[model samples]
Each structure stands twice: as structure tokens, then as C-alpha cells.
Target: MEEVFIAHGGCPHWGKMPTRDASYLREQYPHFGGFLAQRKAVDPDGILLYGHLREMLGL
Candidate 1:
């Protein structure tokens, strides 16, 4: 239940299923999955998350 209120990508708009799109982000970086906490714990450098954890992290 606590996970429901937790912020995934520093905001709630990212949703429970974000995508690896090439679209332009006005403020945050497009591929900035680095900001995600879960992604950081597994792969702080973001090398592994791109292929393995993208779906899990909703990014």
C-alpha cells in the first residue's frame, strides 16, 4: 500500500508504465531513468535497467 504513494520518477505523471520513448522532454532528460530509485538500486549507472528493469520500473 505504501508503494502506491511512492514517487517512481520523482513525479506521479510518469505512471505505472512509462516508455523508453525518444520524445523531447521540456525539463527532465528523455532517457533520464537515472532519477528512478528502483533503477538506481539495481544499476546506479543505468546500464542494466535499460534492457532488464525498464518494464518493472515503468520506464
Candidate 2:
């Protein structure tokens, strides 16, 4: 897989093709952070083992 870095509120051209913001990138950090944290818990041997950790931390 290849990753491309583009600045927010900016655009890049590819052979006369234009890529524009489609409201995919959210302005809130907590939303995306929560997503990753959820995925992390589903990980093997993750913090979900701890009962309190899952309830309080949502890890």
C-alpha cells in the first residue's frame, strides 16, 4: 500500500485530475482518536482484558 500526504485545505494535481475535500476528514480529534482506540482494544492481548479498564477507559 502507498500513502500520500496532503495538507488540509489544500489540493494536489495528478495529470490534470483534482482531488478535493469531501468532508471525510473531520475537524474533531476525539472522533478519530476514539476510532483508533476501539481498534486497539480489539487487538490481541489488549487492555480489554481488564474489566475496569474497558468501562472507564473504553480501551
Candidate 3:
């Protein structure tokens, strides 16, 4: 049987995932460019969570 996982807390609305907005970071804090780049590379798959119910109803 194949195994599945339900990972939580990485959603943008949850406010826990690292920011991918490079331009915003660059303008606000130039020193964090390297850190942000490293974070982006860590999650190559780029999976994001959204409300399925809300999306289905066009919320």
C-alpha cells in the first residue's frame, strides 16, 4: 500500500511558511537575500495549501 501524508502549518494563510517574495525582501532588507534564496531552494516542490471547500464554492 502507498503511504500518504497530510502536512499542515505550511500554508500562506497560516502565516508560517517562509516568504518567496524576493523583491519585497530585497527592498526591505538587502542582507536577507541569501537567507531567502536558501529557503526557496530548500522547498523545490513548492507545495502550497488552500481551502478546498472555499475554492469549490468560489469563495
Candidate topping TM-score: 3
Candidate 1 lDDT tens digits, 1-59: 32453335443344344333323232346455545655578776767655424554446
Where in model 3 is the C-alpha error above 4 Å? Answer: 1-22, 48-59
Q: Residue 37's C-alpha lDDT in candidate 2?
A: 63
lDDT of all predictions, in order shown? Answer: 0.47, 0.42, 0.39
Lowest lDDT sum, 10 consecutive residues, model 3, at: 1-10
Q: What number of backbone clashes does candidate 3 have, counting pairs of residues 3 or more apart or in separate chains?
A: 0
CA lDDT for candidate 2? 0.42
TM-score of each: 0.23, 0.26, 0.31
Instruction: Go through the candidates in order and give the C-alpha RMSD of each one to the true structure.
Output: 8.6, 13.0, 13.6
Across 1-59, the per-residue lDDT of candidate 2 in tens digits comes to 01243545343342333333223323423375666566586875664445543433334
- Name the regions of candidate 2 deviating beyond 4 angstroms: 1-30, 44-59
